[model samples]
Target: MPGPDLLSSQGLRLDGRRPNELRRIKCKLGVFTQPDGSAYLEQGNTKVLAAVYGPHQAAKSKSSTDGVVVNCQYSTATFSTGERKNRPRGDRKSQEMSMHLRQALTAAIKTELYPRSQIDIYVEVLQADGGAYCAGVNAATLALIDAGIPLRAYACACSASMAWRAGQPEPLLDVGHVEEAAGGVVLTVAALPNTGSIALLEMSHRLHMDYFDVVLSRAMQGCRDIEIILDRAVRDHLAEGWTKQDIVTI
Candidate 1:
């Protein structure tokens, strides 16, 4: 449960947003030409980049006759967190995050379309302020789209936190690091918002069953909001053209 001090008397959270408000989202697609597809997304203080590769032949161990295999890797920059980390990858936490990312994205991708092929999606967190996982999911979704990989629907992720203010249960959408560290149950959901299908649902700490619906609903709304932001970014990037410079004779 969250303490009263976490919420201001003016009915605003620490970051000055209403309980259901999400952080600002800014994103760009096809940011790197080197990769098959690449995207960068910023969710408040969190920043993430995702790159997608293939629909090509699968690796020996991962090949499958039934469908394409989706391989995912999640890594964070050394300066991403408040505390500096030594290595970028191969750590226990990174390994676990990579596996979870694979599971969530695999559920949304249309794997059967390319049998014996593989699609690789890698996410790098350049800055973290909580909800890094959600940002990675959104960035990966855009990268996959840029890569021309077929997906059933846009996969998005958002987090919700339970806060009690004045003895009232309030669910906060898109928790930041401060809110997350405030000792409350954080519910992270990855879903296909358009289809109303959930791909992943993870909750930390504990919350009463009665408040679950409200918190889950808030997270779903955040996902929908994020999808709109990402869509706009893709369109904007396309409209901007190749370079910031204008060609032609001065």
Candidate 2:
């Protein structure tokens, strides 16, 4: 559904990125002292903050015997977008995003290692250029790591959109707000790329079967690319000493 203008004649996107390029990502861990873990991430203009608490005692009703419970809350600041949205807490969209966050995070956590405990993750969208959910997922992953939580693998998320360039089809990585607003088909994927497994996948608007595989692969590739960046950040943090507790701006 994207207009022809989505891609220029030079095969560059509206944001001047190549089809396979990702927006520059900058992130920091240990952003706050209060939370057991906290991180801030910015992917292009989309910014998100994530905090993690617990693996502590869970309420009787919500306690799980088989594995640790994962509770997630996703919120958006009123000023995050160009238009202010004075929505109440637990709005339908926020609740849905919270659920999606839990789904993707649970896949990476070693839940069975801590039964009858709960891990609470809170993510707030500070800016919403596009792909807020994906940014939240990436930020939460860093927060969990900051908390020293064990994991099966890194959980990463990315999105792709289909566009037409010079009469041929193209897949766009890291869809920006402009591209998202163009009414094009967007596919979002969360995965454990190291383990070769998918955590969550969502799409807005229908896309043809012929184009589905390519779009999905592109998103997966983005995840793999992001994981490397995150790993390097963690390594740098370790080298600097986690006890130093400085905000790592990478």
Candidate 3:
């Protein structure tokens, strides 16, 4: 079988985004009432939900003397992808994703302030068009913010892939599932965009040294873009609640 055609004749990706363009990211915070904080995010076709619970007492084995313990869980619904998955979390893939999610969130969280305590983060993918890890990180960040947790900066993530256009290498930003299925090298980066610092980086395959810089740069740019959108959503969420309260009467 032939592989997917990732790039179009016009140099656009299969999903109609330009090589440097990211898929639309829409998100909302406080989506769940049960959790201390929660958020839902949609990046193109991929959808994810994140909930945070804690700053509570930590188990003796897990407690840290100088910082809070960060626990993360990543799962994909059985119907999230084209293939029906029998389970969500027991698989090795989910396990690896869980560690990566922890890496990203831990960097943004102010763990030192809550010593001997712990924070629980749970992320679930409702749809997986591509870049599930990146979407999960973004959602988790929003959930953390909704929980009123302090952090050095907002953590965000994005994915990039390389494609050829007229014999010239072009780095694609925020790859979709179709591009992902093409078996190309994919670079995923999680970063504290406001601080211009990376928290974690992963790749599907080895990439040539010459192309690595460009691809990683594209992914970083995508992260910054995602941060801007998330920041706006947070501001809007705050404004909505503020508008309802007549502060003058209080």
In model 3, residue pairs whose N, Cα or C atoms come closer than 3 Å (at least 3 residues apart or on different chains), thus clashing, are none
State, as a TM-score between 0 and 1, how close model 2 is to the true structure: 0.96
Ranking of predictions according to lDDT: 2, 3, 1
Q: What is the TM-score of each candidate against the true structure?
A: 0.93, 0.96, 0.94
lDDT of 1 by residue, 1-250 (tens): 5555767878899999898888999888877866787888999999999999998899999899999999999999999999999998899988988887887789889999999999989999999999999999999999998887888988999999887777888888999999888878889999999899899999989888999999999999999988888778777776886422122212
Displacement of residue 186 (Cα, Å) in model 2 is 0.8
Model 2 lDDT, residue 88, Cα: 29
- In model 3, where do residues sit more than 4 Å from their true spots? 1-5, 242-250
All candidates in order of TM-score, best leading = 2, 3, 1
Q: After superposition, how far is residue 110 of candidate 2 from its true place, in Å?
A: 0.8
Weakest lDDT window of 10 consecutive positions for candidate 2: 241-250
Model 2 pairs in collision: none
- Candidate 1 Cα outliers beyond 4 Å, as residue runs: 240-250
Query: Cα RMSDs of all predictions?
Result: 3.1, 2.7, 3.3
Find the candidate with the highest TM-score and give its number.
2
Lowest summed lDDT across 10 adjacent residues in model 3 is found at 241-250
